[model samples]
Target: MDQNSARQMFENGAFLVVLDAPTGIEFGIDLDTWETGPLFKGLKMIPPGIHYIHYSVVNNDKQAGIQSGFLHSFVSKEVVVRRWCAETEQLYPSDHVSAEDVERIRMGIRDLDKGLGAYPLGSGPNDSYARWQKLTGYITPAMLAQLLPPNGEFSSATGSVYEDEEMEEAQKALHHATAEPPAALLDTTDRFNFTHSDIRRSFPANAPPEDIRKYSRDKSWLLKTLLSSRWHDNPQDLLGELQLAFVIIFVGQNFSGLEHWKFLMHLTLCCAEALEDRVLVSRLFVPLVRVLCVQLAECPQEFAASVLEQDNFIAVVLETLVLNVYECSADEMRTIMEKEIGGLRKLLEERFSWTLATGRQLQADADAEDGEYAPQVIHLD
Candidate 1:
């Protein structure tokens, strides 16, 4: 009813914007022979919003001697507003809610609340349960209860699809389980990747709470396999194998280029340092890692990597630190007679020196004429 509420509702809604090739740019190039345009199109991220914008153009003929080619571009914008039933239905401001839909919703919500549940979705790839998820949103045991046959009962949704008691017994009898449990069914698109597929297991916005422990368990199988590998083996023979595994992992995981590079860098850095003497040596591993990290920092855009599996951005920072310290610990610093602690201290000093040099170089390279932030100032009069 109020202006503030209207504005808030509008901002929270979604929008669909379509961009088309521009057409008909004219000129007074005598006899109207001037062209539509030349190539120059890009995106500018406007404040807080996701936009799917496309850039395209039509050129009847490309220039051979700067005498041909025309360009055109255009965009159409629209919004998707989530309006209230009363306003859209044109009912009175105080019109009461419908009793039947309310009852249906109440029963649905109650059924979904059970700790465990199962829907006899279809036997097909996308069954009734999958449809239910798209419509209702949350996963819970209670909803399963409501969906059971007239004489059936409720139970906590637990274990694998076959491990749950009711569902298991029902399975033996050749019947579908009515157990309603909150679960995000796996999408066919993400089954291959260990990480992304888990994203589908979300409860609908208001679905019941179903125990998701098992469904999410499969997500870690690949990670467990990698961690079990012999990280402390002979570096001369094993580093190559481990690094190959890492490359595959980095490519498979989704994120950004920077992310994967950083993760690979961090894990490799650890493996290098951990096995640094008998089986491996930090001195050798450090240099290889430095090259990778330096390359990662220079790249733009997201990279693919398991580093995202690590909390926050630790993988990125860790790799950068590893590269920084390894540069100093490589040769002259690889002295013996020195305790392990002393080597670590020297490596740290090297990292600090690198940081100082890098900062100084960046500042020195700034353009004074352009009034960059690094411009030196003498304030005293």
Candidate 2:
């Protein structure tokens, strides 16, 4: 593009991102890979929207690679400076860039034009930005602030509670004997570590008295309690936080995040009435049920009722599935109901003597159809 066009674009607040990395490192933003120049500078006329930046480092063999990515929302004329840490094999954010360095780079974009790659707006939207948006559309800054790991920590470094639970008793005993309990555990008054009681503390102190009363250790009560809270005007705020937890698990590779996400999802499913009445929440019932189905199928004996619940929690899933089967009409919804939900119903019936009203209705319907088409018996036969 001509200098005049570039200057015009810059005036509209396009982003200039500078990456300080080894020459051969494969750097990319969204779906477009930058052709590595001397300084690895990317000057893109971003359309003032959310974007994802990703990179992978070639290992010593130049064959193996380690990948990391992040999401950011850009404003016009935003200059983001990041540096790749060869030692840690990670990328550091613009926080490390000195003001002078940023100013110098910002002032000299024209002079360094030869080294910078323009944003690939010509690239089809589907192949690049649109795909990234689809993957991350549910994630928002508020969700990130509440769910993303503090500082530079990712999910891998923070091992899950379930993971810690899985250690052999002997190994745990040995490790506990040698290790001092962390300071967080030693404190008597502060017990907020994502457990039942801990989750209650998430609500603002000024929340309504009725809302506060809803808190409980039972996983089934989680969604009910959350809905009762005055966290935001819309229920989706809480759901966005839940989605962040889920995304952190699957995308962030944080099993601990999944544990939390699943805990919440399980609880939400328990509230069968909400899945029927609330439009905001009913929409999520399908995905939540799908996850539960996969979890149950993958490990049939993995589930157990919450200690805090008065009756069998497994019955809750059964009740919800029955409700969903009768009410759900969408093709995707019916498909999941037939495949995952239907499988769960069968599992419950065979394993626990549980019965499905919907299953009986389906059988009745089929029997009625067969009777209608029954052939008259012939005496000659």
Candidate 3:
């Protein structure tokens, strides 16, 4: 972006470490790494304890723009935000908070929970944020749904663990907060009992039914995927969860069942109203490739309007579908996999190597960056 937006990123608690990547090096240092020496010449004035790290440089050349990171770290980490658009402030957001303010904010959190601001999930009122804390251990990029107003409003009490009555009361409060309208509510009356064999049923009469059946019946595949779904409260309806788990299971490493994930994803979208655990729904998308399907699944008008807004999730989603899926076509598949095919079968198999690959191996002809940290690199190390 511009110099203004860059400053905004620094102010927003981006852990903006200035790696000493000065231009014109015979052999360059990874500016993204820890600066072991006094490269900043004291201009960076780093504080001693719990200080938010950052650096400023007028590189004058093209060594700017951290590829796609300004927005990613903005959304990922607990970065501070100055959101101030004033010219000078835009020029220097690092000046937004002083040493005194930093200490005050840290101590304020200490005061909130006697040194722990975040209460255990399900402990506080069942507001959106509380559900988020419950779903994921801590709020990260996906847990934005957990943000709630401070106490004295619709907050749930997060009292001591030993207080049984308080805990019960907290539970009650959370249920109310998480409650939804009738249509949005799931059919809790009838428990769905699904079997691994039940998922083996026909898949469109004209398709490869036998091959699909083989993958579904693979118990080893079913079990591995089942581990994530085992915690269902109503164990009786465990089958329905299992059927959904099939999307991840049947696909396995080869990703044969990608079409199934696409079907399930669209089904989730048809019933666009969430299960009061939007953050859980979001974090299940830790496999970055699912980003697009998840966004369409959210189905918010305002959100759709802001889809063009720069967020790292959107960028990675585009890269996965547009770039990687195209690469898969070299194997002579006529129709390339569409974004509509959910569960991101290709991304899951390729991104994390989710298969028991024995003799088979993935080898790049030349040096290639591919991994979680791959997208972040701008210059070669």
Candidate 4:
């Protein structure tokens, strides 16, 4: 930006004040990261929006520690203050800071301006600012509150009680040997409110057996019920949750985030009926495909490899989605869906050497297999 525009933004933009953060620690907002210097305090001239603020503690050996972060919504000209807990190596709200001290610091903000870095806004659509917005477009502040921990923070190390139960015996023994038992420090009650773990039980408890069987075979009912009940009034929120889970996995590197993402992908792709809904097609699937494209493009190589592995959950679901769109959707919707799916296919082929068969190809393969497996008529009959 030019000097005049910079000055205008500086006057109107939000501010983040970090108190007592260790020098040399890694700090970042959105897609930009930097090593903290002696004079570093926080960020300034931040554009108003929802943003991911992440950091990693620098250990004695100068290696970065586990990544930790949280999502926050900033309003124009707002000031957000947080304090670093040296003992815990985490950032927390500065509620304990005295009112007079905070006021004194605010009054001296100009003196501290040199210590704060301006938020980076890249130059184009493919830049950090624009990409971050696209990745988080559907996410709202309310959704963050519902999904994040009670402390409103997430970390690579975050785990649930259920995860603890699933841990290997050797891992449990290792944790027991530590001075501070990780499990003991963990908040057992803290868990993300993703969709139900079991799609088979998505139906009501008292529902008829046939209804249960139908729901098991086709998740259209489950999809509709979740939209009406959990994400009521806006179908877009479903996409929002999916985006949120992906960001959590991509940025936070949290395992639970991956599980949540997988569950949502299955739920979305299996719902053939949703392909027929105009509102859902436009608001959910269209943007969802775009989001997935970006995510797949930017995801780590290991993650991409896992997705492309033979018969993997994501790969299988994507194939199912293609078949559903081709067979069940109207011509106009199918055209749109095919165009989007084509882009995804191209990306997969270019990046991973994985080919996703078209709907016709899949059908042809199934037909050939059936013919090969067909029983011959008996001459006696």
Candidate 5:
């Protein structure tokens, strides 16, 4: 940052005060991380916006434990305080501390300035702050409240076991017959309020058979339903949720986060009919393409190799989206669509060797072969 910018941030940026955190633990805010030192308090001069604060506990051997984090929206010159719980080995709001003590700490912040680190705000495209801003551009405070857990905490170790309502009738009956203890039934860990979607149940029960079949095949109706019910017809909110899910997966390293991301990809990419809505095409897909580009470019190689192998779920969805847009859009819209899609195609090919054109051609060949298969009648008839 330039001197003027640095001075502005120093005068106005928010503060994070972490109290009694152990030395050598991995601590991070946004994209920057550090191994804590003896005097480590927290970050200083953080830009006023949404940021992910995360950490991993370290063992005696210095190996890190499961990552955990939460999103916080900071304001100018605000001080947010958190204390380490030695028994639980986690960070929690410093509610138990007396107000006077906190006030004293706030008053003495300048004395502890040397213990704090400045937010990483380098002036470049690939800088930590810039990339983080791109990743979270659409995320709003309202979206965060709707999707995050009630306590605003996220941990890789936190997960939900099957609830009785979600269990099969047969399983419930068996459990009752065996008289399993309630404690053994499910873990008490909290889950994020991700919008629920099931492909099998995408179509409405009251729809006619033909309409149901059409809805199942097209998924446009499902997208509309979710837009109305879950996102309040705001496409940007849906995109915001997508950004949140990916951030959770990428930063928290949580498996449930990955599941949420996949469901959203299916919901957004499978809707060919949605492309007809100019508002959706411009407001959603335009930024959606940019979001996916950054995510795929920054995605870890192990994740690509393991979770999304060659011809994986993303490739299939991208193929469907490309074909649908080409077949459904008008001539004028194709230019903008092609530009965004072309950039995505180039990135995929360069990074993962995923050729969408080849995939589309192969799918066509397979469909043609299926069409050629028929039952024949001979002279016996």
Candidate 6:
């Protein structure tokens, strides 16, 4: 936005990040970091919304930095504080300042601004703020608390068994999923060694009897069933868990985070009505499909049971592409999406008995070519 607009937006309150350490430790906000001398303080005018603060310990050995990050939300003119810990090589948050301190900082912001660098609003260091908002708009404070726990450490609360071995297993699973599963089932380790156990542990166990029957009948049914059921009154309650899973996997550097993304992808793709909306389609659909293409390829059997259920996964995706994508997307976006969708369909057909094209034909016939997609019958047994 223009300077006047920025001034009006920022005039309310600012977020403060202060490093009390003596200057050796490295620090950064979002994607950019300090390469020079000690940046003891940073102050900036922030738009009211959720923002991310990612930082890592600077490696003196000329290698990659140790990255860890967190998310925060700001209301209008709010003051947020974080102090750097040299020994731990991490940031710890401080409570909101008293009224006297707020006045003092506001009055002295001029001199303070001189010492501190401005948090990049739009351009230089971190322009990925828009993407961040898109990915995390559904995340609420209660959701964050549930996912992050008290200390903001994912591994601790979840008892994550993700290790190098698990990573290797994940790699193996990806290769297997991308390729065809062998005729003979290999050792149990090949199937159960990845982070699936950790992910399954976190799933809601006390689903309704019918939902439980659906889950027992097909493990893939568990996700949609959980997604449809509410733990409380809120429709969006499951989103918090999904958000935590995202933060852990994406920013928290945990491999198990993909489980959350997978569940989210299923829910999003199932929303055929929502896909019809131009704004939601442009913002969410393509990105989600892009992720889903890779994921579905990586773990086809993970959703194979779900595919056998009432909703045909492949048909919904294709229908979304054929109907919704062209109208909402530009030529370039449209081309990339068609290519990705084609790849996903090809992968499913080549590797499994059910052909995606057949599903599409069935769905088209069921819809009477009216644009609404329907599922084709499948006999997985």
Best by lDDT: 4
Off by over 4 Å in 4: 160-186, 202-214, 306-311, 374-381
TM-score of 3: 0.20
CA RMSD of each candidate after superposition: 26.8, 12.4, 22.8, 5.3, 3.3, 12.6
When 5 and 6 are scored with lDDT, the better candidate is 5
Candidate 6 Cα errors over 4 Å, as ranges? 21-26, 31-36, 95-107, 123-127, 151-235, 263-381
Better of 3 and 6 by lDDT: 6
Q: How high is the CA lDDT of each candidate model?
A: 0.28, 0.53, 0.28, 0.79, 0.79, 0.50
Residue-by-residue lDDT tens digits, candidate 3, 1-381:
355753443333222222222322111011122222323211111111121112222235724221111111133224232222323212123354566655554344223222111111122555433332222222222112111112101101211112333355666777788883223222222111222222333233344766456443322233223324543432222322323222122211112122333333332222211212333233332222233333233224443334322243333333333333333333322122333233444443454332311111222311254644366747877
lDDT of prediction 5 = 0.79
Instruction: Please give the distance, in angstroms, between residue 82's alpha carbon in candidate 5 and its true position after superposition.
Output: 0.6
Weakest ten-residue segment in model 1 by summed lDDT: 66-75
lDDT of 6 by residue, 1-381 (tens): 687866675576456646463354444454345642554565577657655565555567745465555556667767665556667765665542355655666566656555565555565432655545445656676555544534342331132324434555766787788885434333322111211233233324677777554434223343334434533423345444455455555555455555444545454554433444455445555555554443344334644554322255455545544443344336555555566557766776775544555434554564785554445669998
Each prediction's TM-score versus the true structure: 0.23, 0.57, 0.20, 0.86, 0.89, 0.53
Tens-place lDDT digits, model 5, residues 236-273: 88888888888887777776666667778888887777
Colliding pairs, model 5: none
Q: Which of 5 and 6 is ahead in TM-score?
A: 5
**Candidate 6: 10-residue stretch with minimal lDDT:** 187-196
Candidates ranked, most accurate by lDDT first: 4, 5, 2, 6, 1, 3
In Å, residue 147's CA in model 1 sits off its true spot by 40
lDDT at position 23, candidate 6: 58
Clashes of each: 34, 2, 10, 0, 0, 1
